[model samples]
Target chain A: MGSIHLPSHEARLACRQNRLTNTAGVAPGYLQANLLILPAQHAADFHDLCLRNPVSCPLVGKTTTPGDAHAVQPAGCIQFPDFDIRTDFPQYRIYQNGEYLESRRDLLDVWTSGHVAFLIGCSFSFEDALTTAGLQPRHQQTGTIVAMYRSNIPLLPAGIFTGGHCIVSMRPYRPEQIDRVREVTRTYLSTHGEPVAWGWEGAKQLGITEINNPDFGEPQVFEEGEVPVFWACGVTPQMAVEAAGDRIKGLVFAHEPGHMLVTDWTSNDLDKLRPGII
Target chain B: MGSIHLPSHEARLACRQNRLTNTAGVAPGYLQANLLILPAQHAADFHDLCLRNPVSCPLVGKTTTPGDAHAVQPAGCIQFPDFDIRTDFPQYRIYQNGEYLESRRDLLDVWTSGHVAFLIGCSFSFEDALTTAGLQPRHQQTGTIVAMYRSNIPLLPAGIFTGGHCIVSMRPYRPEQIDRVREVTRTYLSTHGEPVAWGWEGAKQLGITEINNPDFGEPQVFEEGEVPVFWACGVTPQMAVEAAGDRIKGLVFAHEPGHMLVTDWTSNDLDKLRPGII
Candidate 1:
């Protein structure tokens, strides 16, 4: 638990040694990324999917080339140094032909040159921004993981990756604070960005009928006059992989829910790295 | 030449009918893109290259899926409607096993389901911004094409795409107007944003020796107290294709240098569509 206060590199070192189980609060201001590793053959389609659905899956880093795991390529710059995709995450979930296999502390036994690692932006990166704006997330206040749900919003399908829904993470905010929340979170582009929907009506519009029952993470208690604000979740790519099923010919690996890769970049770095205007 | 003032769809229609030869000033305020078409096998690596080198290749649109030409996928939204990759561009240059083949008005004779089309951001998109700021490009004032050069800066390699240099386009501006020039152009993210290098020293840093002569497009004269400004060019991917030589398995097609794909989207639409903080 004390490792949460460490810098990104030290936290990653802690993760490598199995000293940490979850990275929810680790390295407070650094960028935390969702992990997804796939076979080289399926890499292109998944890349195209990320390009098409950036809000759901904003790419932060990836292996320089297929099978090379040491350096990561973030937007605009060539190298994110001192990182190993295989051992940097606290834990990894293994899936084969769309079915869950098991969890591992590291991918030492399974990773190969045929694999390509991708790092997607995580909602955790924007949590600090919310707190800084004095709008603490209800789940964080209750000391639990943020609530995530599968929405009725269908993603634009790419290649054999089809029939996937946009998974969203929710946080409770008062009606008055919603605008400020949007103003704060929207700047964290590499993260999930602005809320996709807000209020109870927003939830209904997304077809999320089970408000209190989340597919992942613990449910939060809504205060009086509070509305549920939803954002595109990083879990989307995992669901996309599952929907593709046996069409995916090889093994898939992702960060265990609540456990992520703490990156060398920060939110400010991402803002600067965004394309076009700075 | 009258088609330059037409709407994007009508301009594309004019291009398809061979009524247009260049797209430099077509459909003012709309986005114009550089075209790169590759066989399905080499598309992935080239996509990876674009990701690694965004300044030289800011992707604005691409085919929905491999072999699909009717729709284009920009950043956030799923589709840019009514686009035909094969015929929308005024002209295309054909290459075989990396060697220069021929130029064609349309790819109808060589079209196959095995090809993928990518639309990269062109410097022409920023010319409108420059003009609006009262910093008209010297090339445009002289009624000539922007001067393009092969710089010594190398691109980050991706798979089979290697040994490629960053190609650049040059425009001259008065020394006093340089700061305003950057402030205006930097906001056009979908277009090549901001000058990568400026002044004679900047050109020297890029390893361009002959300032008066360029590899492509006509040369422009620098006035007294004016300096050369360089931005990452859309021709980079083409030069990369030439560098890779026969490693590319099948046919490759790119817009004839100055002829581009006029898109339905505008600069304002791109600003709103940019990921994060919009």
Candidate 2:
């Protein structure tokens, strides 16, 4: 609290103790990721889906064993120290074989050694890149969850992770800024790179309806030449997790998108650093 | 012939007569691609090879007909105008079942109705991004081809293409520039983004040698703060074609080292663009 730039770990810790319960943004510079914890059995298919749907799920970090938390990286990357593999996130969405069960605050009710969690890359990382480049996200400026839409485009499926349409967040920009912003965000996002689609028709194809009214974030005015630029959201994976359901059983992720594990690993590491480091 | 930017017709006229026999750098704004012309019988395996070895052999365009020299594209953005596909290239390398039979100035001698030509991406498209960002390539400064080495890393093999150590082109960059260079190229290079290896032991791992020496191009200096960054060279497809030796009949690519087909598609169009335009 006294000397920190990003407070992801602090907030997660607070939430673990029931003192903090809010949507992310509490952490500033540190990367925020979507969590997808599951058992070892579905690991390969989930891994394949992330690989196939790289634009939507450009993997940040993962584990081989179901509960081997230390298997994440070359050690010393988790910011909050040795974490409990079973009960780290603030909330949990439990499903029974692809059916919605209920969203619970604690998994202590059914914790086990057979589960593994994944920390996925989020657009939050690019929010910093955008702010630094003076292309601050319009949704964040208005304090809203950026609009996400189910698109007509189909995702390349993996195993049973089927039929999840791409979910995207939009940011309006002048046509000129589109290419430059493309250069900026891509340079920072590393794994996923820049906007996969631009132009109004691409938005329309993705099921976006408004130029000014957004489905997720605070509605903002498109002054002058601003046009909507959309990127596939990390929520696609959650949809996959939900679709996989509980027959696969014991799936886990950060609770309600509020709790996230801040890691010592740089999400940009594999993207920016030489692969030899591994 | 005297104009600054030669139109498609003029460019072909000059190319047919051997007048425009150097690098096609002026036709530089859009996509430039390598050409691989083979018989229809071998197209399936070759296409499969391109699909498997996408990084080094990004298939930009291809002909569905054995001798058709046209390609269909997305909603008309840019296109290679109708020009002679046979004589458009400055040089052509003739391969008879993987053997380097001869190098010719044009394809006039072997133009056949049963040939299918493929257009592949050139690394130069990424160079535009480099210069646009004010990053100067050391090889360009020294005025030479970037030094290329055969690395010990085995390529992902496909039918007719056997796995062997990959051929790599090396560019020495200071540690800081690695991230920038990697990110910039990664945005447009498809699966070919980022450096694969960068240490002294890197060459040996790929079964390549003469650390300070090279098999092709002039030596690149690894300045005090720089480390050599290795990328899977586009010449990789050549390796596959060579390995496919005698398994099929004829094969050839356009003449001149960097000379390639300029497509009507964007390098960003990871799928649609065909082999050679015209």
Candidate 3:
């Protein structure tokens, strides 16, 4: 229950049995995904929204049919088999009519035939890749949540999903290290590839008025030579849902921010150049 | 009318005035694009299809409103001003309810209140870029059309638009030059990016039964020590339209093969590493 080296399936088993409640570093090399479930009626529109705003919502898996628990394959880079949507994650946040209701260990009670789930690529997987490449993610070393900001960039609108400004996650690095960081991250296109913005100048272009004060997550102090580097955040779709409010029909469900669904597929599987490794 | 040197706008103007019927290599540094026009009824689904199959349909610009002649700005790398959808392309292939009508020099008489235009990225611009870097595209060097084939890869389906097998354009190069070619082309994400397949082994995986006998364009005789390289072709969407058949709601229009709409933006603008160069 308290092991850090559990495999992805075992981690999900722990969550299913109520032994583990969060999945931060569990199965470190494997991929962890953000879960978003909506009523069947909104699937096509949401699918279009993901397509239009690929940087913010890089969809990894989705249900073939509404009410189906298994993730559907669509010429995916990696395949995850034998998983249930109802209880894979450590926690699930339920929203009805676009309003937050509550968070629970599982969605078994709320699960219905009308639900369609979307598994979006999470940035958490790439952080491990970055660390392995000798680039420390600022938030992890300082033991704080990564800073997140709402930028001026507008997302492409689809159906009822009138996308709002883009949400970006921030990290700090010296100017010289930015190129190496960009190269490493560029390989993982599914998980917010490369830094979208670098330094205060880049941030301002995205209309991030303040660097230290983030809209979400805890703020961190930067080193003397560090500049803020921003990547498109996976939390963007959730924020868009919240911003859409009444426009969203029926209910929506998402993974509780830090509690992602760990997959058997490794993080390296996301790299296009390196294939069949996992 | 047949000049080799002209800006993108002037080449487009020549096409507009029925003075030019071909656009290959005319605007050397500028970008050339594939055109697709459809009715508003199928716009959302077609847009979703393009978004899903970006490799095959790298959308550069789209009409803001149905039947509008002007392109909509969406933070694109290039901007084309004072362009008319009805006659900007050298030739337009009209398809009514998914059935081929005929090719025409202009669409002024056929243009109606229900059509929407989409400008897709063309591989022609990248060929020029490759030549500048001392890597010649096989077909361009031979003074023939680029070899193309239908592959087994199916595009992700959208509403009323079931995707067909991907169509890939082929070029030949020595095995050693593959890496450099990939590196140079990787910068143009909007223009089919890098090679999807290289050599006979790669082509066979895409279900191309024969290398010399291509599904479209002229067959090429490979030079000694040369391997065939494949990049996703812009013709893929047209194939999707053909595959959809009666599923397509209304009339659709496309640029005739080898004839394209030249844009004011330079080919360098497509490179993310080199920004604002246009």
lDDT of each: 0.78, 0.58, 0.73
How far off is each candidate at the interface, as Cα RMSD in Å?
16.6, 15.9, 16.1
Sort the predicted structures by lDDT, highest score first: 1, 3, 2
Candidate 3 clashing pairs, residues 3+ apart or interchain: none
Which one wins by lDDT: 1 or 2? Answer: 1
lDDT of 2: 0.58
Per-residue lDDT of candidate 1, residues A126-162 (tens digit):
7887888898788777778778999865554555575
List, residue by residue over B186-237, the lDDT tens digit for candidate 3.
6566777667767778777678878888886778778999988888888787
Q: For model 3, state the Cα shift of residue A207 in Å.
A: 46
For model 2, the docking class works out as: incorrect
Minimal lDDT window, size 10, model 1 chain B: B269-278
Tens-place lDDT digits, model 2, residues A98-202 = 555677776776655777666666666667667877888776676655666655444544555655556666777888888777666554332344665666865
Q: For model 3 chain A, where is the 10-residue window of minimal lDDT?
A: A269-278
Q: RMSD (Cα, Å) of candidate 3?
A: 21.5
The lowest-lDDT stretch of 10 consecutive residues in candidate 2 chain B is B269-278
Q: Residue A172 lDDT in model 1?
A: 92
Instruction: In candidate 1, list every pair of residues with a backbone clash.
Output: A276-B189
